[model samples]
Structure formats: structure tokens, C-alpha cells
Target: MKFYRLTFLASVFLTAVMLLLVYVFDSAKHSFSETNKQFFQTLIISALILSVINYLVVDFLFNFYGKRQIQKISTILPEEIRDEESNLNFKQLSQKFTDLNLKNTTEIDMMKEMEFYRKEYIGNISHEMKTPLFTIQGYVDTLLEGGVENLAIRDKYLERIDKSVERLLNIVKDLDMINQFESGEIILNKSRFDLNEMIREMIDVLDLEAQKKNTKIVLQTTSNLMFVNADQQKISQVLLNLISNAIYYSNRESATVTIKTKVENHKVLVEVEDNGMGIKAEMLPRIFERFYRIESSRNRSDGGSGLGLAIVKHILEAHGESIAVESVYLEGAKFSFSVAKAI
Candidate 1:
């Protein structure tokens, strides 16, 4: 419509200019014949009009396509994205598009990571469960195949089956405990207790393992009793897990595992250090992840539910504390945590 209006006005102006020129330059002797004058003016006007119409058509097509492309872009957006009167500029639209693209990319990456972890988790669970299940099945089969008729064989098979069953029970219990901790179902029974004394008790409980490994367990501290304000039982569990890990992973023939405590500000920092095949720097960050074994083959032989470190971490976090690990590849590893000091 705009192009048509402009062309009509341009034609009128050109026609007026022609008439004015003819009137201004007319001569009496060579005055143009009316028919001849009309014919010549018609020829000039036809050429001029055709050129103008061609330029107008090109200009109109350019604008038409530009508007059509913009309209196509607008339709890709949802209706609720903008109000009818909100005239968004190209720059603003481009920024919004970039933001949406980034968000989509992040979500996609997260989903892929989750899928990978899911497969790893399932594989680990199956392997962990299957070992004990198979052992128990084998022992039962042995007893059924006339081994039960012999008193000696029957007793041995029964013992082996009992041990396998116990391992299964431990795994199940650890799983249940971790589930409860994650779901916020277990409430802490916080109280004031002697941290050092608790460590002593835990050492006594783990004495056989330490002796078996020929590792000497020692406690080093400024005082024998460093009291802390938290759940004693949970803290004991943390100590047991860390100390036991230290003992189990120790590579030295006569490894010395140390439990040390210090008072810093209003917190008691406890560290379990061992001169063992220390964890590699790369594995430190993931040491507390559930079922993440530093030495899968050796750890399996050592025997555990593989949820010990994870449980310890959750227990510390529940008490508003945090745990950290420091280690060199071959020197040794130290696991530490801080708890509020009893006033």
C-alpha cells in the first residue's frame, strides 16, 4: 500500500513538470502540432513510468521479505512470552535466546552425568550383594550333596554359611542406616561426652583387627579426655571407621595408627593418621562417596559393607561438623573432623 501511494504521487509530479516545460519553451513558428505533442509526451512518460515502477517493485520486495522473516521468528516464541504492545528489539531477543540455549545445555549435561552414575551404582550394588549370596548358596549346596550326612563336613559348611549370612546382614544394615541418614529420619541424641575416652573404647573394640594387621594403635593428645558436645555414639562410629580404614590400608609390617586431638578455638579437632599405603591425591576427594573403594580388590578381601566412610561423613554432617582427608600417594593419610567443645 505504501509503495503504491508513493508511485501515484511521483507520476503526478512528473506529469506536471512535463506540462510546465512545454508551456515555458513553446515557439510560434515551430509550435508542436497537438497530436504530435501528445504522442511525444506519451513516449517520454511511458519510459519514465516504467523505470519508476521497476525501482518501486524491488524496494517493496526487500521490505516484504524482511518483515516476513521477523514474523517467522516471532511465531517460534510462545504466546505468553511477551505482551502484544511489548516491542522487543533484536539485541534483547538475541540475549534471551542465548540464555535459553545455555540452560538447555546445562540440563542435558546434568542428565548424562546422572545416567552414568545410575549405571555405576547399579553395577556396584549387584557385585557387592552377589558375592555373599553365591557363597551362601555354595555352602548350602555342599551340605545338601551328602556333606550333611558327614558330621565334620556338615559343621564346616554350616560355619561357612553362617559367615556369608552375617556378611549379607551387615550390607543390608549399612544400606538401611545410610538411607535413614539421607532421608533425615535419624535424629541425633546430642550430649556432652569425653571424646578421648570414647576413642579408647573404639580401639578396644577394633583391637583384634589391629593385632591381626600387626598395627599398633596409639592415641596422642594433650589430655586423656577431650570432651565434646555431640552424639557420642555417632562420633564413636566416625572414629571407628577412620581408624579401621587406617589400620586396614596400612602397608607397613608394623604400621602405627595414631589418634590425635587438639583444642582449636571452641572446637575439638580429631585426626586419625596412619603410615599406610596412603591414598593418592586424586582419590582423596571421592574417598567418602558410598561404595567408592580405593583398592577394590584389597578392600574386598579386607571385608566391609563399603558404606563406612559414607556413614561417617553423614554422621559428622548431622552434628554440624565436616570431615576432611589429607594424604600423599605413598607416605600416609590423615582423616580429620572437628566437633564443638563442651563448655
Candidate 2:
């Protein structure tokens, strides 16, 4: 409707201009000296013919250009929005272009963010591997340069080299485990187990390490047997990591790490809290990221491959659960997670 209206207006304007030129030429040639009626008839006939021709030309050109523009737009539009039965007018086309531009900008920003993380991950891996490799190389070199003759020196260097090799192996092993989890290669073998008993066992295992830090691990739970449905091995690893971290990061003279559990609805809520140097609030978001450390000075010497918390997070997530943490810097921190209660 709009197309025909525009062409009609344009044809009228062009025909009027052409008629004016014709009138001027006819007056110069005295062609109007015939009857006035005949003169008017000739003018009307000329106007009708000119108007028809102009309207046809304008309509053809408009359709040709409009189709070309629509074809270009169709190529860029998503399949969901493209319509062959209906013509997209100027307003709809403008809106689609705006939406496309915004989508492209968002995608570009995400790509840039992923690129940054990729670079950071590569650099962290290199640094971690380099430290252990260098330590092993230095100690081996010392042993080769006449240091092997002394029994004491050889023993000391060999021990240090062994520790470095172990650290390298730990990093590789943790990385592989995390990769398996992320790639869906590790399957959880869910079983019903006593959550309380597991926590007690973990405390018994880490008791000596806690004693070295003058930290006492205490389990506070409402029941002696809180059964949960989860992978027993992975949950044990989670408990170990959390408890170990609590013991390691405790700064008090005689710190205390507490494991608390309670039955809530159809789930078991387990928390590992500690009276340690808590993490900063700003660093909480990245706390579970692989190789991320709250304290820059902490290294593999502090007894972690830096993938413990990351593994804990992955384990819980695989069980259709999540972990949460709360802390006040220099005061204390608590890590909590939940599991399905066995029916």
C-alpha cells in the first residue's frame, strides 16, 4: 500500500513538470491556435500518458532496489527471524540490525574474557612446573659435581630431589583428575554411608598434622550416624582437603578446627570451620579456582598442589551439589556443602 502511494505521488510531480515544458514548446510553435477544446484534450492526453509511464518506471526501480537491500539483510539475519512470505520494512530491519550489533559485542567480550583466563592458566602451569624442575636440576647438578663423594651431602640432595619430584607428580596428578572431572570422564559411584563416621575417621587421620600446628579438630554433630548418598572416596577427599586447609592456615597459638553436621529436610548440611587466618572477602569468588592461592607466599611447600579446593568444588558439583564459604579476614572461615540424605 505504501509503495503504491509513494510511486503515485512521484509520478504526479514528474508529469506536471513535463507538461509545463510541453506547454512552453507548443506556445512557441503556435500549436494551441486550434480550438481551445482541442488544446485541452491534447494536454490531458499527454498528462495521462506521461503519468502512466512515470508511475511504471518508479515502481520498477523501487522494487529492484528494495529486493537487493532485503537480500543483503536476509543473509545476515538469523534463521529464526528470516521470513520469505512477508517483507521486512525499514523499521523492522533497523531493529534487527541493532539487535545483531549488541549480540556481536557481547560475544566478542566473552571471547576476550576466555582468552585472558587461558593465558593466565598457561602462565600458572609453567611457573608451577618450572619451580620443581629447577629444584630437581640444581640438586642433581650438585650431586654430580663431586658432592656425591660425601655421604651426608648425597643423602641430603637426594632427599630434596625426591621431594621436588613428588611435588611435580602431585601437580600432574591433580591436573589430570580435574581434567577428568571437567571432561565427564570420572563417574561417581554413589553409595549410602555414615557421614559422621567419615568425618571422625578424617579427623583421626589428620590428627598428627593438626597437633603439629597445635590445632585441635573437633566434630560437632547432632547424630552419630548421618547417612548420605554420595561417592564415598570423593567425599573423603573433600573432608581431607577442607580439614587440611583449616589446619594449615590457622595462625593462633593453639587453633581449633571444627567439623559440624546437621540433618536438614532431605539433605545433610556439613560445615568445616576453623579459627584460622580467614581469607579476604575480595578473594572469596576465586577461592575454588585451580592454582589460585589466597596468600601469594604459599607454595607447594605448604602441603598442597593448590588444586584441593578446586577438586572439592568439582566433586560436590558432580553430585548435583555446591559448596559455599564465609569468612572474616584474620578471624576465621567456614566451608560448607550439602549432600542427599539416604532414604
Candidate 3:
């Protein structure tokens, strides 16, 4: 820090020295005697030296007394950007540092993301627990108030309780998967897998639900045996969730959700395109956000908890892949994502 300050001061002093030489050549070069010219030059040099000493002493005192706090904190910073934090006499030092440097962008984004996850994890747990607690309380209250004698009513209460328990179990599983992802504990078992076959497998799993609504799932791909290198189980879960979401949100009787795959620019791309009611333009960017739902998609028929897309996002990101979407308000929606190249 001190050397950097000295270097700046030296540059200023060098400019002053040049001005003095120019002034002497103009003012005394033609009119003065050799002795007088020499005296003038000596005077300028003396003044320059004194000026530097005064400037250094003042700058040193100002830095030591006024900026000492920041200097103390400078120990935490990387050497190259120490000066940007040297003026940190205020509480917004971190904000100022973030605004000044590239490194801070990555760190600040991580901080904000971690903060978001902290809040979301708490909220999701509360929400998932609320329904079960309410069901358990209602069932216990009913049994205590003499409804237990009615075998059919008692069975109904038990069934509701069981349903709530199952949902809570699902929530716990989702939470466990998310925790593993955040903790860097999830290890992918990448292998060659038939992308088209996997889509067919997912369609088999969800085709009954689609049939009940008269919706059809069309499978299309550049190749039937387009192989992909990915964590087969994790990628399957992501694709299943996306395709199911598409099927669930399609409002028309003739709704068609297509699963397609291809090899593009050395990456294997998979897309789930649906001619559903489509997502709102405003909600497009935030759909993958945890616990977020398209308000118009209020029906339970839209499928499981809003955690599905968020889970998909984490799984893809964990595998160094990414997801994107395009939607027209009433026309359709397309979700495209890519995995590592097939080899």
C-alpha cells in the first residue's frame, strides 16, 4: 500500500520537476547571467525537494491517522485491489468493494444465493409440515369427540392422515436431495444411456395421467439411439419432472407435450415442448425459483409441489448443464437444456 502511494506521488513530483525546467528555460535562459541562471535553477531544485518532503509528511500523517482503520482491514484483501478498500472509512465498505472489482461479483452472488437458500429452506420446511400437522390435529380431535365409533368416518380420517404423511415424506426426500446438492456430497454416476429410450420410459410412467385428460405425449429426437453421458438416475428425475410439469399444465383436451433430444455443438440437448396454456412472460424468468408458482396454475392438477423445477435446476447445474425456457402467453412453452457431449 505504501509503495503504491509513493509511486503515485513520484509521478506528480516528476511532472512538477518538468514544469520547473521549462519555466527556467523560458524566464532566464536569454536574459540572465550564467551565475544568476545557476542560482535560479538551484532555487527551483531546493523548492522541489522541500515540497516533496512536506507532501510526504502530510500524506503519511493523513493516511496513518484518518485511514488507519481501512489499512488494518486491508490485511484481508488480495494485494492487487488493496487500494480500492483503502478509503473504507464507512460502513458500506463491502458494497464499495463489490462495485469496484470483478472478484467481488462472484463472491457477492454466492452470498446472495446462500442467503436465499437459507430463507427458502426454512420456509419450505414450515409449509410442508403445516398440512400434516393440521391433518393429524383434525383426526385426533375427531376421534376424541366420539367420531371414532363410526368405522367408515374413522377410516376416512386415517386415509387423509396417510395422504398428508406421504406428502410430508416426499418433501423430506426432496429436502435431502437438495441438501446433498448444496453440500457437494452428490457424486454423479455418468454412463452411456439412450436418450430416446429414457423419454419413452418417462412417458410410460406418466402416460396414464395424460390419457385421463386426453393429452398426448409425442416423442421426437434427431436419433433414436442418441447416446448421452450423464448421471442416469439424476438426469432421469430431472427429465421426468419437466415432462410431467408440461403434461400437468396443458389445459386443452388435445394438448400435446413433446420430448425431443439432439446433439448440438458437442452437447446433447433435450427439450420438453408443450402446447399448454403456456407460462406468462413475466413469470418465465422466475419459474425455477423455489416455491414459486404461476398464479394462473393454481390447480393441484398442475402436479406436485413447486419444488419440482427448482430440483430440476439443481440437478442439471450439478452436472454442469443448464436449462432454459421460451413461452408465449397463450400459444405454448418450450424447455430446452443440454448435457455433456456424448462420446
Candidate 4:
């Protein structure tokens, strides 16, 4: 409507000016009676035709260019494309394209990361299994070659075979648990319980193992019976994993592992810290990953399944909580997690 209106006004204005010019210039050459009326009529008809032509051309060009741009953008982002009736302008479409481009870039980066992790995960699993499998095979081969006939080394070889089998079983069980957690198959049975008491119970269960290394399990907290709302059994497993890690990794002849708890911000903050050989800064981020171990401690013959921290992570995530670790290279390592306070 505006285009047509502007065209009409322009055509009328030009026609009026032309008519005035004709009168002024041709009045000297000829009389302005019959000739002037004919000229005026011709000019009026020409102006009306030109106005209609201008409106049609302008409207066609505008619609054609607008629809073409919309089509091009829609090919890339079909879901984000607006309907024909929408009042989307060129600037709005450009902004939408920018946003879509950013989202696509981010998704691509994430896919690349997941691919890297997938390959690494497969490699780690293969390496972990092959080490024990080959050892067990070698022991069996030796036994078959008459080592079993000699009662002296026979028992030693058998014990080593049993330990290898146990390690393999632990890895498989831990992997299964991780899969169940990831698939949401393990449902947590939540209950209100005394968290301090539970920690003490864990310490008691691990007393013998700690005694072997002369590691002291100390409980340091503001209260003796801090209550928490969580899955009691699952939380106990978490405590066992963390405290045992501290004990196993302690490098000193006599190490002190402290279990501390305090009520903070409607939650109980629990920390299991050990004065052990702390982890390096670079290894901290990957510590919770399955089968990931620091190179320095990788050869240490410990009873860990290498999935303790991973299990702890999954269990805490199932409880809708997070766990964190802090450590210096040679000072000590601390693992902390929060639980809901029983109100």
C-alpha cells in the first residue's frame, strides 16, 4: 500500500510540473486552447500507467529477493525458519543464523571429545585385562610343566594364580557396577542415618588392613553423631573406597588418615584426608576416570581395582551430589563430598 501510494504521488507531481512547463514554453509558440487540453489528457493517462508499472516492479523485486534469502537460510536451519506470515526482517534472520552456527560448532567439539574418550577407554580396558590374563596363563603353563609335582613352589604358584583371578573379577565387577549406574538401573534406597557412626564403622572394618601398614584412622569432627539423608549402604561404599584409597596410597611407615565431618549450609561436608604421597596436579582431573592411574603409582603392587574413585563418583552422582579432591605433590590428598543434612 505504501509503495503504491508513493508511486501515485510521484507520478502526479511530475505530471503537474510537465503540464506547467508546456504551458509556459508553448504559450509563446502556440495558443493554449485545444492543444493544451489534448496534451494534458495524454499526460494524465501516461502518469497513471507509469504509476501502476512502478508499483508492480518494486513489489515483485522486494518479494523475490526476500523469499530467496529465506529459502537459503532455511536449508541450513529448517526448524528455525519462520512462517511466511511472520514479520521477520533481514537483521533478525541474520542473528538467528549466527546463533545456529555457534550451537553447531559447540556440538561438533563435544562429539570429537567423546570420540577421543571412547578410544582411550577401550585401550585401557584391554591393557588392564591382558596384564593379569597373561600372568595367570604363565602360572598355569609352569604348573603343567611339572612345577605342580614339586610341593615347594606349587602352593606359591597357586596363590599367585588365585590373586590374579581375584583382580580380574574385581575389574569385571567394577565395570558392571559402572554400567548399571550409567544406565540408571541401580536405584538408591535413601534413608536418614548417623553419618559419623557410619564413618567409624568403616574405619573399624578396615582396621586390620590399616594396621598392616601402621596407618592410623582418626575421626576428627565437630560432633560424634552428625545425621545425613542419603542411601546408607551406598554412602558406606563411598566411604570405604575413599578411606581405603588413602590407606593404600600412604607412602610413610606410619600415616595418619583423618575422617572429618561438619554441618554446613543444610548439608554435611565430609572429608577423608591422608598424609600420603599426594597426586600430581595434572593427574587430579583424570583421577575419577575409570582405570586411570598416575604413572608413578601404576607399578605399585596394591590391592586396588583402579575403579575405586570412579565408583565413588558414580555413587555420589546418583545421590545428586558432587565430590572433589585437593592435593599437593608431596604433602597430602583430601577427598571431600557433601550429603544432605537430615532435617
Q: List RMSD in Å for every model shown.
A: 9.3, 8.3, 8.4, 7.8
Error of 2 at 125 (Å): 1.0
* lDDT string, candidate 3, 189-275, tens digits: 999888788888889999898998788999888876878889999989998888888887787978999888888998888889999
Ranking by lDDT: 2, 4, 1, 3
lDDT of 4 by residue, 94-134 (tens): 77778878998999999999999899989878878887888
lDDT score, candidate 3, position 299: 45
Better of 2 and 4 by TM-score: 2
Pick the TM-score winner: 2
TM-score of every candidate relative to the true structure: 0.75, 0.79, 0.69, 0.75
**Candidate 2 vs candidate 3, lDDT winner:** 2
Indicate whether candidate 1 or candidate 4 has the larger lDDT: 4
In model 3, state the lDDT of residue 206.
93
Name the runs in model 3 displaced over 4 angstroms: 1-121, 296-303
Residue pairs in steric clash, candidate 3? Answer: none
Regions more than 4 Å wrong, model 2: 1-65, 72-86
TM-score of 4: 0.75
Summarize candidate 2's per-residue lDDT along 16-92 as a digit string, tens digits: 77878677656755755656676677778877877787777777667756766787768666764575434665566
Model 4 CA deviation exceeding 4 Å by range: 1-60, 65-104, 295-297, 300-303
Candidate 3: what lDDT?
Answer: 0.79
